[model samples]
Target: MKEIQHRSDCPIAFSLDYLGDKWVLLILRDLIFTSKSSYGDFLNSNEKIATNILADRLKLLEANGFIKSSVSPEKKNKFIYNLTEKGIDLIPVIVELMIWGSKYDSYDVKDVVKKLGKDKEGTIRQLREKLSARINSDVPSNE
Candidate 1:
């Protein structure tokens, strides 16, 4: 397989290259919670991403192997996209964002925020465990 080049050696910088934009993470947040797919579904998200930007980000995400797209068997013209394990590994980032935003932004995630604040490492460990368990179940044990 061909190697993929990261923008920088720093872990944060490299991660930013993958999910730096606001729209990318917003889209990911939707995917994680709603399992939404297709152009129309994305356009209808709470953040209201523009059609063109969503298209571009989805393409970039696919190229980077964060997601995979397949045709909808139910509809000839529809498409569906699903997260890869690499993408689902972002739960910690989302959880951290939840904590930070809950602090400074005063969002309504108090319950989760309280949980994270109470035990940050424990929260991360549990989140990672859940993600891993989902991966183990969703994907075959030996793939």
Candidate 2:
């Protein structure tokens, strides 16, 4: 991994240095909530991310340890992206964003966002557990 220079010592600044862009978080959202993995899947998102930017963000995310990519077992020519533990840990932050957006923006609160708004901690706990299980099960056992 390449070394990243931080603009400041603050934790938020450090995090923002990598994830400050809208596209980065949206890519993460798809990985966390949807069945998206391939480059094509991301390109087809409602946001209609440009090809060049999507490619750049995917490379950056993988380099920064938020995601890992593996060749799809069923389709040798294709790749699948999965969240790392660090990425999975960002669920709470994403949930908080959803809560904040729903509250302040005209965004319609979806079922998941409604749950998050109602019980933030509980909702985060449940999402983390589910994501953790999925990530762990996808890992091949050494044994």
Candidate 3:
């Protein structure tokens, strides 16, 4: 990973230095919520991200230890992307973003927000556990 120069010691600035781009968050959103794992799948998302941007974001995500890529077992030519533990730890951040957006954005997210009502912490815990289990199981053992 390349050394990133932080403008300040503040944590928010540090985080934004790596993840300030809209594309980065959106890609993370797809990984966390959807079953997207391939280059084509990301390209096909509704955001219509440019190929160059998608390629760049994927590389950056991988370089930053947030994601890992492996060749598909069934399809030798295809690659599958999975979240690392570091990435899994960001689930709560993503969920908080969702909650914030639902409240402020014009789009109707009432259904989703209603589902998350009053138990935000519990919801975060459940999502973390589920995703952690899935990610751990997907990793190959050294033994």
Candidate 4:
């Protein structure tokens, strides 16, 4: 079967072309807000992303320069995935979604509120620094 194509010229459509899936955004949300960086953490999410789907998203996200994965210091068998500069730049998107969720999705997220309260811009700035500092750019590290 042929894959369906999105023909809209809007940038949102373009973005969605790569990351429009429901699971991708949530995974991103968790990474940014929860500082989650490992496989087990993502697997343990309340969203309960399926293992095969999670693996697929991780590979795609990495290919698109959205995230990078590295060996965990505490667990050699596990990988700790970190968002790249491109990924960190998604803070505003996450902020907007969280706000939308609180307003419409009916979840009480004190974490997001607190994050925004304590210097929203500064928080995003710091997040950017953290993500950019360790970008792997799909380049194989000399491990």
Candidate 5:
């Protein structure tokens, strides 16, 4: 991994250095909430991110330890992207954003918002557990 220069000592600044861009967050959102994993899947996202920018952001995310990529078994030339523990840790942030967006932007996330409103911590825990299982499932056990 290449060394990243910090703009400031603040935690928010450090996090923003990696996640300040809309595209990066959107990509992370897709990884967490959608079944989209391949480059093509991401290209088909509603945001319609440009190929060049998508490629760049994917590379950055992998380099920064937020995501990892593995060659597809069915198509060796293609890669499947997955979230790392670091990326999975951002789930709460994304959920909060969803709740806020539902309230202000009037997004159609009412079902999720309602669940979160009833049990925010439990919802987040379930999400993390599911995601953690997915991530762990992708790895081979040493046993």
Candidate 6:
């Protein structure tokens, strides 16, 4: 991971230091909103991110504790990425961005956003729980 140079102690700046890049957020959006998890899945996103940038961002995300990766059981050469607790905490932020973008930025309203409109807290809670379950399920069992 590249060392972050904090310009100041402001909270937003600190966040930007980690998540300022559009690609970073997009990757997080894919992780949160879609079923995509593998490197090929990300490489094939609608945004058509370049391979090099995707590789760099994935490494940075893992290094910064937003995500973690493990070898794919079916494909030894591939990896499956999952959100850590820190990354799961960003679900609300992604939801707000989706809502704000749909309203002010002219982005299409996704189904989750529609649910959010009806019940913001409930929608976020459900998303968090779903993601937490995914993380828990990924853990290997001793038995």
Most TM-score-accurate candidate: 6
Q: Against the hidden reference, what TM-scores do the models get?
A: 0.72, 0.87, 0.86, 0.80, 0.88, 0.92
Predicted structure 6: lDDT: 0.87
Residue 12 of model 6, lDDT score = 100
- Report the C-alpha displacement of residue 41, candidate 5, in angstroms: 0.9
List where candidate 2 sits over 4 angstroms from the true fold: 1-3, 138-143
Lowest lDDT block of 10, candidate 6: 134-143
Descending-lDDT candidate ranking: 6, 5, 2, 3, 4, 1
| lDDT, residue 39, candidate 4 | 73
lDDT of 3 by residue, 41-143 (tens): 9999999999998988888888888888877777778777878889989988888888888878998776546667778787778767876776777544212
Model 6 TM-score, 2 decimals: 0.92
What is the C-alpha RMSD, rounded to one decimal, of candidate 6? 2.7
- For model 1, how does the per-residue alpha-carbon lDDT over 71-91 read when each residue is reduced to its tens digit? 666776766776678877787
Sorted on TM-score, highest at the top, how do the candidates line up? 6, 5, 2, 3, 4, 1
Q: What is the lDDT of candidate 1?
A: 0.72
- Itemize residue pairs with steric clashes in candidate 1: none
lDDT of each: 0.72, 0.82, 0.81, 0.75, 0.85, 0.87
Error of 5 at 55 (Å): 0.5
lDDT of 4 by residue, 2-120 (tens): 23267698888888877678988988988887867777788999999999888888877777778888776666788878887778878788887776676666666677566776787
- Cα RMSD of all models vs. native, in order, equals 4.8, 3.0, 2.7, 3.6, 3.2, 2.7
lDDT of 5 at 35: 83
Candidate 2 overall lDDT versus native: 0.82
How many Å off is the CA of 25 in candidate 5? 0.4
Candidate 2 lDDT, 45-131, residue by residue in tens? 999999999988988898888888877777777777878889988988887787777788886668888777678888778777876
Which runs of model 4 end up more than 4 angstroms from their true locations? 1-8, 133-143
lDDT for position 55 in model 2: 85
